[model samples]
Target: MSTDNITKEKFVLTITADSIKSTDPRFDINNLGLGDNYKALDAKFQNASGTIITRDYKKGEHRNTNQTMAKLAFQLFETQIINLPVEVKEKFPVYKENVDSELRYGIYSSVEDFNRYRKTREYMQYHYGDGKVFVIYSWNVFSTILFVQECLKRFGEQGDKFILTYREKDIKESEAETLESNVQKELDKPISEYRNPYSRKLIESKNIIFRGAPGTGKTYLARQIAADIVSDGYYDTYESLSEEQKQQIEFVQFHPSYDYSDFVEGLRPRINDGVMLFDLQDGIFKKFIAKARANYENSLKNPEVIEKETLVQEEIISFLNEVEFGVDQFKTIKGSIFYISSVDDKYIYITIPENNIVNKLSISIDEIKQMLESGQEFKQIKDITRFFGKLFATQEYFYNFPIFKAIRGSRKKNIKPTISTEKLKKYIFIIDEINRGEISKIFGELFFAIDPSYRGRLGEVTTQYSSMNSKVEKFYIPENVYIIGTMNDIDRSVDSFDFAMRRRFRFIEIKADSTTAMLDELSEDNKDSNVLDNDALKDEAMKRMDNLNKAIIGVDGLNENYQIGASYFLKLKTLTFNQLWEDYLRPLLQEYIQGLYNEDEIMTTFANAYGYNETAEGEADEAFESEG
Candidate 1:
């Protein structure tokens, strides 16, 4: 039999139909084959001859008949079987391959097809015995071509298809590049190229010694530099800072007794938990350093935005750092930028943002001193302003000024000037006879503290004081403070200054005749016409003072002590005709030139030098005689 007709044979069998009813509503066997059947034979079936057949009948069909019946049974069950269409079945084996190929060629209609292809590949991995077979089954030549096309589409022209794409990597690289550019921009300009002399490059020098004869403005220049640095922002022009910024500056004085406890911070008696204890207080140096660090941190976090609280904290911390204190150990506080005085061992630590940059400068004191001595004029207003602004705004040190108040005749009250609580930027401490003080004895270990290299760092020399029972204390100077000292070279009292102390300051000489032009200008001003208008007279007075300085210098054993100052010439403006003779001219002749003069000749010499006789009494008479 052919396969197509294999289910066509049938068998004749009889069964009773109890009732002609169907379980399904749509179709029933009675409706098709039992049409018009009567109720008399409802539960029974009869053969074509109408004869009853018993269950024990021995008659049966031939062998071919049994086979034909079996075939008919199979045909009856065929309606229950499932079958696919010939066209679908023919393509089923290669369907996934074709779909995957389309996807790989960038022709995917949807992600579902792509996912199915991926799943098929994964399935073949476990089912296929050989890896090569799995690979071949999973990827056809067409599918491989499609995959390459899909990869090219997903990744842009410059993108690498093999590597996984990550947005974070690109973002991080961009950030790194930005940071590098910013850092490079800041480093591009050399510090020395800055026009301001008071900037870090100039102030941080190690060997700077200010030298000049008395009143030549050496110390004044130093003070100006300090003010400029401390009062103004490091990068801002001098005019930019608000009044409050200028007011934040502080000053302190260093002496032989001044120690680390005073400058860097130390423990002092305090009540804690109702018990007396030594509470550690941060010193000026430590406070300043802390401020600098805090400022730096804030700048990093908030950039240019400054809050009031931050400023206050910065000021307080800077003050604490400037003085020596034991509390610094617990807090690990460091020193800030500062300056020191050779006299009285005074030092100040100015707490300002500029100090952070200033601390990094590597300059020597000698170089600064040389710059001042060379007198290379600075022209830029910004430079001058910055130099002066820092000097006044930052910390400074000074010796005690003795205020002599007359209590009674022949007796006086000598009181040491108090430490000034006024803002450092606005104040100037002038030492009239700075060189007269014993430098080493007064400054002690501060000699090195004043030096630039050790000015703002830790682990340098410490100072011990008698008041603290010789306990060592850290000392640091503030950058804002300025020191001005006037020296009389002709005075014998200045010979005790240590060489080291002399080297730390910048000096400028004030020749007695140097100010003749200024004096003439002062004399010519009509605002006070009656006040000695003779430029020639002022010139002569300056010449005499120079002569006096020369004479003193010529004396043996008086090299350091023999330089006369311009201040002595100023006395001429203050003395009356008679007072000049009694207070100055007569005394000088008697003490230094008495043996060389005759009795009558000495009076004549005094008359010529003083420009008046002692006998001239009234002001009107003296004026009339001069005019005549």
Candidate 2:
């Protein structure tokens, strides 16, 4: 009756036959009077189903003759007289005098009996617990210690004894197996993969812009980040990306000329019936979104497709193996001859000759075999001979099958198929020099959709030319398609960025440290390859560039934005100290110091830092004037 014995543990309550009827004197079964011949009390309880249920036996007995307690007996029986609310109001509560406890005591016939009681409740409640209380349900004696509100209110009067009667139920083997199997599956999967740094921010914001000074590796880092997300940690660089992964990525430059007509959907002039007519066409961004969306939706419908490609390929091969062939391998009708060349873990190779057109029929190998067996002539699908080219094993088209059209992430021949697996693919659109283009003009109505809170179809809006394309009246940027844009702070100040576009993107700054690290890598590579005439030259080059950047930053109007990057000095291998300054660094410095009163003096100081000679300085001045 003391609630202090309860401990916080997993809800797995195990009760054995011996625990109910033990030989020990501390817990005597004979005293309880639960034996083979004992009969239950006639007392009954009504359930929601209106079924009148009776107790097998209670701690105190009920006799038909005297209506008094009978001698205790013991025998395990399976049936409950009263329904106990499995719907527990509290969960995992520490039993204390002052605190309300989620832990409740009830007698259950079996684990399944407890589960049934749980199904009728709203909150998640389990019947499993570290046993501190005992329960038994049977026709001979239904004995269990229960915590009831009525008994607790009158604890001193009741003397801490609350007996309940319930029946036992059987547990099925199949039900036990299914529960174990589901638990095993849940345990096998990894909990974290895309949970990398910046992933949460990018996922929430949906759009991010990487802005920094030139040569800060903004473009390189963007591509790496995009590759990482798309490949799901399988790839992090351009060279590491698979052909399919490459398809999920797109790179473009934004300039003054870039517009909505080129970036999104727009009306284009087309020659229809020998007359010029305007036709609505989707631009790169829209097309990319479609591809990403198709993959995303397909992934949901077929999640196993992500890692189960080999199984699909095997199915295709097994189906093809059943095809009946006469000679020279498995040849299709219509003279489009093809045979299974080989089969590997990842691909099913089908060899077909150049002249052997394998189109006209658009179906799986199983379907074709069935049709041929039924003597059904297949109608030729015109201009589909090229489609069969993808099936040729020589071209790595093993996964292509008629059952489900493959979502090829190839940029070429932007074919819009009815089904796609783009959702499975993390599509990235990298916009270089993003601020160079007019944001309001290029994005147009898509500005609303770019906001992270407004992402997905919920944020869809009608485009400017929505009236022209009935099929695409409303458009939204998909969640899977990540956007990355890079900008040079020197070219366009942060203040110049539109406020409308500002809140939508998470901006990250890349500084001169990135450039220095890049140079260090280049230097190490040159040293290992023995390409440098003098190793010390690399160090001097780094110092000069760093000093040059500081000097530019110190200039009256010029800040870190206008500071020269390491890329300029990275050309040190072929050019000497004087040539590097006179040809590249000096000419560039001249441009930076242009229109200033101290221009000549500043040029002299920069030239001196580069150890410029009188002749080299004269040549730099002449080259600067000619450029102007």
Q: For candidate 1, write residues 1-628 as lDDT tens digits.
A: 5533422322122222122222223222322211111111111113335643212211121122112221222122223211434333222231123222321211222233434444332111111123211111222111122222222333223322211111111344444434433332332223344434644534334334334455333344444444555544253333354566543333354444554565555677965337576645656545554444333233233222333333333433343345343222111013332322111112221222335543211112222222233333433323332443333211111100000000011122252222212222322233445565556655556677665434333324544532342123345543332344556554455566667877766555545444343344324432423533466446555655555555444444434232434444445565543564467555654554345535456456445444555454546325633553
Global fold similarity of model 1 (TM-score): 0.35
Candidate 2 per-residue lDDT, tens place, 1-628, comes to: 2223221111111122212222222233323332211222232333234454333443222232111111111111111112223433222121112124233333443534544544221111112224322232211222221222222332212222222222221234334333333332322222135533544445545678877667667777777677767767666577788887888888989888899999887788966337576656779888888787766545444333433443333444555455443233433333345544544343344555544554211123432222222332223332122333322232122213221221111112432323334224467788888888888989998888877666566688988887543123468765567788889886744556778998778897777656464455455545422333345556666766777777777779877766666666666655555677878777767876789998888987776665566774346434432433
**C-alpha RMSD values across all candidates:** 41.3, 19.8
What is the clash tally of candidate 1?
104
Residue 29 in candidate 2, Cα distance off native in Å: 36
**CA lDDT of each candidate?**
0.36, 0.50
The stretch of ten residues in a row with the least summed lDDT in candidate 1 is 398-407
For the record, the alpha-carbon RMSD of candidate 2 to the native fold, in angstroms, is 19.8
